[model samples]
Target: MGRILLAVVALLLPAHAQEWRLTRSQSLTQEGTRAWRYTLSPADRAGRELWQKLVLQYQDHLRAGYRVDLGSWRLYFLGGRLRLEPHCPQVNPACFTFGALPVEKGVQDRFLLGLSQLLDQALAQARNTGGNLTLSGLFRVELKPGQAPPYLARPSGWAP
Candidate 1:
């Protein structure tokens, strides 16, 4: 009886938990602007299916007037619609840009603080170069199931 119960419990668990693996990355600079591109892939077939489901759910939430917050970044559906391109292997791999922040006073310092939490050494190098250098390289980051999701709805009363 115990063995049967254990088997049932195991079956109740998901076959593949969501895990996004960084597959490719590249830093680019064009016309004095710097940006980084990353390509994330699932660990296996099950992960791929899970990723698709999450994307659909996220879209539905957005349609319902939910705002997405990634760390300090905030995104809202403008004009009642937000266009997201489909992820295509080798062509377009789910792009997310995080730079070109507004030049308002104190904005750069805050942005750098948030960035430093993610890549401390990179920011250190940039500081050493008198802010002329920017992060440029491919980095590996494994997203486990318990970690933060790709994005989440902003909490009520949240500021900055």
Candidate 2:
């Protein structure tokens, strides 16, 4: 739903890109029906975008899923963020088709998270070989001050 995406966006984005070090971390939690998480530490804009794509995709599968005999099914790829309505061949309802929605550009913090969720949903629907899927590593974006034309000061002897 649009509200779900909006709520996640509003609840996550931060307005300070100057100080802290951006961190990208993921944790896997297996509970009632295996739940996992992939997120960025010191997270920023890009991460959020990735997460958004994932959530919309996850929802698409859930909405479009239908079991003819209650077990076998066909999984549909719902692109990125869900639009006004999605249409799947199996499901006639407009909502079934998670259309092409406007994904926020600079939301990096949550992007990976969304991406992870999407992958998980895909794995679930996909009857292929999939068990140990991972999105691992530290992601960083730096913004440091550069030396000026006049105020440039050379390193005054290296200090420990």
Candidate 3:
């Protein structure tokens, strides 16, 4: 009975278990404006699929102004770029708005263009080699000197 239950539970789990990670974070200048670049990578197959789906649906999401939930992070399309914020639960009484990492419009546009090309290349590579491919996004965050940078939460099961 224990064996059967374990098998059932295992069947319910995702085939590709993966989580997103902060692969890169650094300060940079864009169009003479101070900014920070935050790159999130999906270190495995599951994460790659999730990121790809989000990119594919980006146009529709942007048009509808929908908020996308990625692990503990919330994504908002604002001012012509993607903004990152911490996800707050509706039942949490202490929920409040924290500052977000806002990407510049020009920078966002260029990134998206490059991402499209990368995806196309990945598709070709996947067809040639029966291996999985992954992708990451580099977000250009506008810096407000007086305020603190937004806190990026560690997803469940993530270790430093």
Candidate 2, residue 29: lDDT:
52
Q: Candidate 1, residues 50-138: lDDT per residue as tens digits?
A: 43443444445555676433222334455543322222111111112223323442332233233323332322333233222111111
Worst 10-residue lDDT window for candidate 1 reads 86-95
Mark the regions of model 3 whose C-alpha exceeds 4 Å error after superposition: 1-18, 25-37, 78-83, 89-135, 144-160
User: Which one wins by lDDT: 1 or 3?
Assistant: 3
In model 1, state the lDDT of residue 81: 35
Task: Please give, for residues 15-121, the per-residue lDDT of candidate 2 as tens digits.
Answer: 32221232223345564333222222223455444435543454444446421110011222234211211122221112122324465433332332333234333
Tell me the RMSD of model 2 versus the true structure.
21.7
True-vs-predicted CA distance for residue 149, candidate 1, Å: 18
Which candidate leads in lDDT?
Answer: 3
* Highest-TM-score candidate: 3
Q: Taking the tens digit of each residue's C-alpha lDDT, what string does model 3 give over 1-160?
A: 9677546534532322224343323345565533333344555574466445545554345347775443323556666556555454221112211112244443332233333333333334333432323334323333333433242222122111
**Each prediction's whole-model lDDT (CA):** 0.33, 0.29, 0.38
Candidate 3 has what TM-score? 0.36
**Residue 122: error of model 1 in Å?**
12
Candidate 2 vs candidate 3: which has greater TM-score?
A: 3
Task: Give me the overall lDDT of model 2.
Answer: 0.29
